[model samples]
Target: MTVHLPILEAFVKLGNYLTDFCENSYEKPSDTHSKFEMVITQAQHQNGWFTRENILFALKQWGDLLTEEHLTAWLSEYTLKYEESPKTIGIVMAGNIPMVGFHDFLCVLCSGNKVLAKLSSNDKVLLPFLAQYLIKQEPLLAERIEFTEGKLEGFDAVIATGSNNTSRYFEYYFGKKPNIIRKNRNSVAVLAGDETQEELQALGEDIFRYYGLGCRNVSKIYVPSDYDFEPFFTAIFKFSDIINQHKYANNYDYNKAVYLMSNFQIRDNGFLILKEDEGFVSPIAALFYSYYESEEALRKYLTENELQIQCVVSKQKNTDDVPFGETQKPNLNDYADGVDTLEFLLEL
Candidate 1:
């Protein structure tokens, strides 16, 4: 029952086909339409958050990562010596965004383990569809992947992703099992006030992608004291069309009203609201900003709240932050909550 690496490589090939079709084809094929094409519609209907753009973005990112070369390179650093000790790894996935819990699923499979996935109701269809596709590509995979509708059981270890409150429940229930229970984590950006207009525009993607629902999306930014926001506003103005989205607009309007009633000063460029606050998670369509006296002070703040922070975006030298706007474009090894998922699975 050793999970051959080529079986996983075939899985990547199937992913490429699915993603390329989604990204390139606009009109549905008359009769030649494949099974994968139907997933886009199914995913959207199942989860309102799974828009065409966001689902396609997630697919494309996986397409880029699931290449034969990329997969080989990524797995080269680790030994596949754990195939002899395969364990059932139960996954309690989160459906905040399209395929948000995919990394854990991928990690478990790549580590030569059996996956018993309990998908979030918000995102139930996509992963199961992908798992079916993988089974089709490599029939042996059918033995390894299973999706459960009821409470998860018969698993030696588990990987669950949820909010801070739900994590306590996970801890209480799965405390004895070897687990990687992820709580809430939000990414942040540190502005040096010297970033280019292009960089700021890229930062808008880090903020607005998934309507700021992802852990990788930046919910807050730290700027230097007295930093001029003219360029920042101007750069992000291009994304004002986001207000056209019904869900996002509703959030924008509601958060704006709450802020106004509370007398908290907020700057609005129509689509997004910018507020000065000392917080990590901001409401949708609103970005919280705080002032830092110096780079050192910002570094100190980041270090102190290291666990709460996912990734830091900046362009300055000598800092350990990720490059501006690359938070969501994480490498395969960039494990969530700073935990190496594959390493955990392999050791289990």
Candidate 2:
């Protein structure tokens, strides 16, 4: 078998293992259960925001997406012609959510390139564990992946994910190389106020998942002017336990106090705050909302701020918006910032 086939097969096994791992914390004596548990505990200790449930949610999402069928379907869209001499693609991963950069790593390997990964300090453990799992399954892949603690060097191209401010530095430093430098982007939901209680409740997951840290997490919603927040708030009560998390609670207290002191008119449901703001990014524990007079207004604003937005969630039969609550469950093809990583790797 070719090297790529073993890698793909290994990932498929890893996905199956992860699905079983999340469904049941099986204490197989020889398995990596103890190490995985340590990594989860360390992740939460290093970053208060990285809760065990959130990390597992991310893991399950990946497990579902990393199937053979999904990989084949995503790769079918491209003619994955690799460089004669495989290029080194440096990936500066984001620490916002667990395994946020795994897709890029997978894409690099799928495109027959090498990965030079510089992990974020906050999310250092899990990806390495997965990589080790892959290499153990397919020893040939051990040569294709490398981790660097110091500065990234000898890379032909780079894929970096960071805030908008850090992107400037990335561009200045990696300008000469073929690179994908991702910046801040937020997701939004368009609610027509007539959605079913189920749909509205799912929207709550989009907002509350990962404490709204991911770019795919819905940070804001656009609703009709006469939208009644009572139904919306009621539907989201299922996620009320989120505030019990001390980090989330701290943000809620801090932002709520700031809003109250500033005399800003805000709606609260004991745990979450809803404020009227025209911004895409909202503070943790608070979601910004804007009253849309018409679909045309929302379209115009979206066009003007296209780069700042990630995915749009709505029930309308529109291609632009994702179904409610599925923002975080992106397929392999849902490239970040709409940039196709596989295509870039092929070109390189």
Candidate 3:
């Protein structure tokens, strides 16, 4: 079945509502002065409540890509060509960042699925508000979307996201049903010494956005041996203002201290560290490091470890090319980890 015009209009309306809400109502630097203050106030001294600034930043970043034309094209492509419809999809959301579930929610809705979304307590408010706005714009959506704190059953399939630790539990629990269990996967960047200062600055957004909490955050850097760190440092130093935020500062201070006390040798260029390691994923506020003797060696390592990687961002394009800053901001056609979710739904 083709996606109806009204449903596509509703998505566009929801996008507009989010954009207006962020620009007008959400806290801005001009209004709040400090994001830390807004975070503390919103959390009521409770830990893990996302700040208004961070939420707004993420929403606006996503809003720019979720244009009316983009939504319409995606709906038409998936529904018309793929033949996925009326799917009962249960979504298990991640709580590490604000509105992390929005993409999955859009996928289910665009695939003509009934979404049984189990929201993370950390992100319960924003998604429901957005869903309500969409429902208001087109009341028919109210019947298709459901939010609940309870366990999900009676769904035809599941799309579950969780940490590596919890992924095992998710697989065990939902393995009986048709599911795509997303385990912890980190995004990485391959920095050839020749990157322009302009490119390095844009890469900083991928590193610092959401305080390096999201999985799409580039937690590891593969740089050539004997590369000058000065230019890279100069490019990312603009984010020094992130130190002013108390939570991120605390994390930085804590991690720096731990590195000092443990006597773990590290390569620091002031704002962030580049430690030599093998793993792709690193802790938030911390990054892993690897040095390559040559591009061939790096390609060999990446090829050998293909199963362990999710997405790779690089300047040289042979294949598997995604734009630099676009790692975290996935477009409608960019299926997660290159898995065709719509195809899976159709088979079910």
Candidate 4:
């Protein structure tokens, strides 16, 4: 189980590239300001916000997290056995957020696999740049990494991320191969009365980061019927500035208008609204409906519909109490949708 020197070197280079790209490429607020202006202009032409500033921020954050020690440790732990020879894995990426497919890319590469990554149209820059950097660091990996805008075939296995609608297509197309098909999933947050102010503030990051467009964003809030909404709203109110941002304001006004015209009763406190519903995912900026009369009822509901939920953010002192704001930026150990990706890769 000796670690391969070449692979380790490539991992180090990848980390350096990420660090330089984040710090050097877009270092100043002016840089971000200009990018935001361009994004707004592009957004006006189309119906989507490119979110370039947020992307830069996330990349910088990820670069900081992917330290040399961390990368080396993860590589050593995950790639020890397959260092000499690795699996060839093809990855179909998702464009839900900035480099949303990066974790999958890291898992495959760290598991000692040749990575053939198909970049999402919404995110076409970062991965290719990373591949080129890796090639320069370790020429041996040049053939191991590739970027494409089209379909990829003839890999030992595949990992594809898509919506619930496209999952069926992914299954039919790559079903014959060893594959992991990821469908749409929304995260949830359960608020116990005991959360500290600091924890709640960090939880706001989970709720508002990337304007709630990410799958790991808290789309549903499960609170006790008697629980006061004041603290929660108070803690999250800092994100009110996001409402002033045109992109988020548009979504809020659009949804609010729909509610008004459709005559759907929505309880609004100006910042956010509370509605009654039975699902995990919420409409953008609009929290979905559900209240628990008792902890027993909440437990019953969770047990009954466990399959529909991804991770639960809570301050409880048990497995049920998922930490606040840790949903989207999962640790290396946090497997996606509760599936152990490393284990699956190893088994294949």
Candidate 5:
């Protein structure tokens, strides 16, 4: 069977609804939008990290990308061959960021596969609510999507996302099936020491958005040995209010105390902590930094460690570098862990 056009249309309508609702351009009051607001509230209540701002940001990004033109362009690259009986794709979602696994969900559906989604408990509210909206738009979608709180069974293929530790377990469990298992990866920014204040400010968005809890967030930076952080600090001062959130402040205080007790040198503003560490993943409210002697050596290091990195935030776009502030706003084709999810689904 060919890919279903109604499924595509349903998602486009969902994209329009999300855009209008987020932009406050909805022509009139409707139950869907009202209930969507409630779902956002419920999501935040379920997960403290799912703050209203972050959820809205995720929604708006999806809205902007889910347009007909963007979807068409994205799908044009794929030969969306479908089986006579759609394969049931079991997706194990991660909850670090709101609707983080939505791209996999989209891939499964658009490739004419059934989705048996196992939502992370922390992110249970948003996708199911959106799924209901999509089902409302096209009733055919109701049969294609399934949510399960129990162990996922009766699926032909699997996609799972988790930390490095849990990935071992996923491999053991889902290894027999056709699977795409993602492990922990963090993004890093390569700073040339000549970035403008505006670029640094935009880098702050890459760092602070989602409270540094996302894989695409710049948890680490590669800076010149003589780099001055004063300008970077000054540019990111506008985001200082992030400390007002209790959860973030608690993490800030805790990590600061730990570093201080260990007598490690750390750079601290009132809100953000910068530690000169050669690690990729940083704790919430903290950033890790490493000194780079030359661009050639840094490029070599990045190429060698590409598997551990999700994105490379830079002033210039390389094949894999995401622009400073656009890490979280990934295009539909920006598959996680550099895996082509749509192609995987179609092959299944």
Candidate 6:
């Protein structure tokens, strides 16, 4: 007799397990706890950006999000069907931050499709470990999840994430196959000058988390023409210790020197540099800012350049605007590139 497993329920259990592990791993150590600690160290060694704190933060965020209530509410919008013979989906993941490709991995499995993932070398450690936990919870997943080191073959569809240049290559190669190809995108914030110290402090989280590597990290800001930088700088001072990380410090020194040599007028707060630029993507340790004449003008600018923006962080909680520091803490339904991964997988 075949044993039937409820995949969704397994995930819910995994969520609870992770939450407990994160909260009480040290207090009640076990073999699994030791393994988690080991993997975190390994991840840090593999990618310097994947510090223990950042990895833990990512895990806790997912743990908090994967509860039954959140899962049910998110899945309720879609009509889900498990196929008798599911399609093999190849995913090209990005390595900008830890577990960046997990949502895609989750979507493929949740839609009852097979995932053949090409893990970025920088982030090759965490997901596979989590995959092992999932497979242990629901043995059937052992057949559904795969990690590939070589070129992806025998895949029915593709989902690739990369820089703009690599995206062109992805399109050329996977053009014939049904695919979701994502390119470089960055998030921006709109400052109205009246933001409270607490709000600005939270906004610092949106900027410095993952050392400003992820697409969701706010890389640019729009401020009123007469905006003052004193309060903004003071509020974000809590994150000043980020410069102690050698990798980030090097980038900070290098970028600051380059800016000074270029004779660009930039506002510096010893750790972070803010430059006036029209671009959305900014270098590490440097934030691009532009002066807007008015809120209406800023909205118009954002509307015209929506393609280059992953999210817009502002006090205003409009349909499109993400509130203050919430950009990096996206929900399960907040699809990247505004494309629905679950819907795409279901159609396949």
What TM-score fits each model?
A: 0.95, 0.96, 0.88, 0.86, 0.97, 0.97
lDDT of 2 at 117: 100
- Candidate 3 local lDDT, 263-328, one digit each (tens): 888767555766677888775567887888888878888878865677677787777755577676
- Model 6 local distance difference test score: 0.90
lDDT by residue (tens digit), candidate 4, 1-348: 344566666766666655676666546545433554454345334334446566665666666657667666555565355445667898999876777788888777667778888877766665665566567777877767777677887688999998898899999999999989988777778777677778888788888888887777888888777777778778877877877768678778888888889888887766566666786777777888577778777877777776677777787665755688667666666666778777788788
Residue 192 of model 4, lDDT score: 72
TM-score of model number 6: 0.97
**What is candidate 1's CA lDDT for residue 30?**
31
**lDDT (tens digit, per residue) of candidate 6 on 1-348:** 111237787788878878888898889888987898898899999999999889888888889988878888888887777766879999999999999999999888888888999999999989999899988988988999999999989999999999999999999989899999999999999999999999999899999999999999999999999999999999999999999999999999999999999999999999999999999999999999999987887888888988899998988854678887787789999999899999988787
What are the candidates' C-alpha RMSDs? 2.0, 1.7, 4.1, 3.8, 1.5, 2.2
- Cα lDDT tens digits, model 2, 48-155, are 889899999999998898788887777778776544478899999999999899999999998889999999998998999989999989897788899999999999
Q: For model 1, what is the error of residue 87's alpha carbon versus the real structure, in angstroms, after optimal superposition?
A: 0.7
TM-score, model 2 to reference: 0.96
Distance from true location, Cα of 117 in model 6, Å:
0.5
Q: How many backbone clashes does candidate 4 have?
A: 1
Tens digit of per-residue lDDT, candidate 1, span 141-227: 788889999989999999999999999999998999999999988999989888999999999889998889999999999998989
Choose 4 or 5, whichever is better by lDDT.
5
lDDT of 3: 0.74
Residue-wise lDDT of candidate 5 within 1-348, one digit each (tens)?
345778888999999988888888346657777888888889999999999889889999999989889998889888876445888999999999999999999999989889999999999989999999899889978888999999999999999999999999999999999999999999999999999999999999999999999999999999999999999999999999999999999999999999999999999999999999988889999999999899899989998999999999998865567888889999888889899998887776
Where does candidate 4 have its weakest 10-residue lDDT segment?
Answer: 40-49
Compute the lDDT of residue 212 as modeled in candidate 1. Answer: 91
RMSD of model 4, in Å? 3.8
* lDDT against the true structure, each candidate: 0.85, 0.89, 0.74, 0.72, 0.91, 0.90
Best by lDDT: 5
139 Cα displacement, candidate 3 (Å):
0.9
Candidate 5: deviation at residue 336, Å? Answer: 0.6
